[model samples]
Target: MKKPMKAALLSAFIFPGVGHFLLKKYIPGVILAGAAFAGLYFLIAKSVETALQITEKIQSGEIQFDAATISELVSGQTAGAESQLLDIALAVLLVSWLIGIADSYRVGRAQDKNVDASD
Candidate 1:
């Protein structure tokens, strides 16, 4: 496979920045990877926190956990600041992943051109 496609596929299939790292673009790779990880971490943390809060409310009889009340309870549980953070984290992760794929492909193409030019 061509370097550009290979790099793009790596970044798309693997975590963001793997392709850049393979191309020896350490700074971009590290930044993309770090942002992705941070977004994921925040998402997981907020999800867990929301889940725990819901569980606590259910356990204490403040919110009933039944088919009729499930929707209401779940919505209410996630209707606070944490939900907004989760949304932002999701957006950031998605954007970073896309940028990483495009960047890695561009870098790979540049490297390929350099190789050809020197031939």
Candidate 2:
């Protein structure tokens, strides 16, 4: 396979910025990996907190186990401000992931171009 495609696939499927690592772009690879990990951590923690809150509400009879209520909880509308923060965190995680993929792809392509030009 082509170098760029290989790097892109590695970044997309394995870890964010792995393509940069493969191309010996250490600083960017580390930065992207760190940011992606931080975003993922925030998202997971918020999701767990939301899930625990929902469970507590259900057990305490504060919330009903109906479709609409469940929908609201899942949508984070009825949960309050923390839920809003969770939504923001989730969006950040997604955006970061996408950006990581796109950046790695671009870097890989550029490295391939440089290699070709030098040949």
Candidate 3:
């Protein structure tokens, strides 16, 4: 892989999709970056926190989000596939970043060439 590709991949890996921004695919990269930091990701993280608390409660024989105790606060009835949606969105975001890395790699490779000075 070219330097630019490596740089872009490194940035995307380090910054969660900023590599695409480096490639001038601003809209997509930004959109993905934003989504990565917001919405469903946030929600699932919250769910994890909630689950943890519930687990603590379970140690006391009083779980909350447990299936038999209080049930999932965000369920299929309450939030249909929202978590799944986030997973898919992140997958797409990752893909876009990868494509950006490839493009940037190509760009870097191009930059290393000695163009004919005739023009």
lDDT of every model, 2 decimals:
0.88, 0.78, 0.57
10, model 1: CA deviation in Å? 1.8
What does candidate 2's lDDT look like per residue over 2-80, in tens digits? 7678777887888777877887889988887887787788877767877888888989999998888977886763367
Counting only residues 3 or more apart in sequence or on different chains, how many pairs clash (N, Cα, C under 3 Å) in candidate 3? 0
- What is the TM-score of each predicted model, taking all chains together? 0.85, 0.73, 0.45
- lDDT per residue for candidate 1 within 54-109, as digits (tens), equals 77878999877786676666577665676787799999899999999999999999
Superior candidate under TM-score, 1 versus 2: 1
Q: Evaluated with TM-score, which candidate comes out highest?
A: 1
Q: For residues 8-60, write the lDDT of model 3, one tens digit per residue.
A: 67555665446655655567566656755564465566568766766677678
Backbone clash count for every predicted candidate, in the order shown: 0, 0, 0
Q: Which stretches of candidate 3 lie over 4 Å from their true place?
A: 20-32, 43-47, 63-80, 110-119
Query: Where's the lowest-lDDT run of ten residues in candidate 3?
Result: 110-119
Instruction: Order the candidate numbers by TM-score, best to worst.
Output: 1, 2, 3
